[model samples]
Target: MRDANREWVFAQRPDGEPDMDSFELRESDVPEPEYGQLLVRVRYLSVDPYMRGRMRDAESYAEPWSVGDVMAGAVVGEVVESRSDDYDAGDVVTGNGTWGDYSVLDADSVAPVDPSIADLPAYLGVLGMPGRTAYFGLLEVGEPKPGDTVVVSGAAGAVGSVVGQIAKLNGCRVVGFAGTDEKVEWLTDDLGFDAAVNYKQVDDYGAALDDAAPGGVDVYFDNVGGPITDAVFPRLNVDARVAVCGQIAHYNDEGVPTGPRKLPQLIASRAKVKGLLVGDYVTRFEEASEQLGEWVATGELGHRETVVEGLDNAPDAFLGLFSGDNIGKQVVRVSDPADD
Candidate 1:
């Protein structure tokens, strides 16, 4: 049994942009669990744009972090020992572990993770929350009809990449927007997105969108909302559906950005734009997971992972996401051969 624990805490809220100083790496005595809790050794940690919103001292769909509190995130782990009958030692598990090498969680917080179909990290990426977010956001909200033309912003990232693939699986013609040409290449050449635009090089995203989807945009899966998103709003077809999954551009922004106005365009096109969160769709996860698992095992839904080699690199890995440093799901390899 370990006598100590190491975890990252929120050091301070950022004024405009988050810096490395916002995080504090700390160590303390290992926390003993209550009767129903289990101690898990983290294997992989997830870094997502939503975590940026939680850092601010403001009202949000989730709570803001108190200074010195453990930052909120998710991890895939192994139950080293269990105090509850619902779990036992050596059970591979997945849950919200945040930025820590180990965590004590209640029985309800952990889920059984199958490594035979997917390695432990896949539970954090392809078959986990990001996967669920993509599946529901695209299928339910975007409603991509077989011949629909879909455009996904932040297309090279975890959720965006997955959304593009799922849209393709549904027989939609998918185009993606990424920050870098390398990411653009990865999306088109590797992930099967029909077209990929490097937003950094494109002065007019709307023009690029038009060039890519000459027929008109039937579905817009927006991961980044800002000038780029504003450009897309007017391009939607009459019955176009927009799934607002994230706004990474706003996440790190110093202030809320004013736009070129959308209601007018919304009225003109009768397009629909709705914000989406994966937690709201629970009944469908099991069904989606079954299908996703099948595709993953069958090599139909291929995935690429950008694994940062160590736990300490977690923050760097997270920050890199906004810069398009990762082409697929960004995960930290906290430990390999986790159960020694």
Candidate 2:
């Protein structure tokens, strides 16, 4: 049995973009599970754009991570020891655990993970939060119809990638906006998107979006909300649905940055734009998970993972999200599940 634990904590709040100095890694003694707690041996930890919001000392849907607190997110781990009747030693589980090698968490906080359905790391990604985000945000909020032109921003990242694929599954003509030519090709070739634009290479984003979505966008899934979103507004069709899942472009801003006043476009097009949070559909998670799992199991959906090995490298994996360094879901493999 392991006797030591390593943890990453929020050292300081970032200004614009976070750096290595923002985190502090420390070693500690492994914790014991209490009556209703289980000792988890972490295998994989998720790194996401939403985590950037938690770094700031500001008010948001999720509370900000206080300085010196263990940075936390979705984690997949195995039970090294258990004091709860619900779990046993060697059971694989997933929950909102910390960025640590091991954690003693309340038994009710975690859900059993079936390695038979998907790979272990997948529980932190496609079979987990990102998949749920895409499912509800695209279907419930975007409400795409058959043959509609669907435009998705950040179309190559975890949630965005799933959003585009789900749009295609709904019989929509999917157009994607991504950072690089490689991501564009992955979207168009591997992911079956009708069209994809490299936003970074395009001289004119508006013209590029116009070319990709000639019929005018009927559904817009906005993940990176900034200029790409500004470009999409003018192309919205009447009664179009826009699912605002994220604004990653603005997550690092020192203050709220003003952009094009595009409410007039909404008025002219009679479009519907609403923000989405996956947690809102907690009651229907099983429905979404089953469908997403089926899609994964049947090869209808392709999922990718960009992994950084070792728990000490977790901060680097997290920092990479802002710079588009990952192809799909970004996760840190703390250790092999069988290592324990």
lDDT value, candidate 2, whole model: 0.91
Instruction: Give the per-residue Cα lDDT of candidate 1 at 189.
Output: 82
lDDT scores in order: 0.85, 0.91
Clashing pairs in 2: none
C-alpha TM-score for every candidate: 0.96, 0.97
Candidate 1 lDDT tens digits, 1-340: 4456778888988876787898888887777777988888888898888888888889988788899898768888888879999988889888887688788878787788998998877788779898999999999999989999999998888888889999999999999998888888888887789999988999988898889989888999999998778878888899999999998888877767777888888987889999999999986788878888898998778777888877788888888877778877899987766334
- Tell me the TM-score of model 2: 0.97
Runs in model 1 lying further than 4 Å from the true structure? 1-3, 338-340
lDDT score, candidate 2, position 305: 88
lDDT of 2 by residue, 119-200 (tens): 8878877899999999999999899899999999989999889999998999999999999998999999999999999888
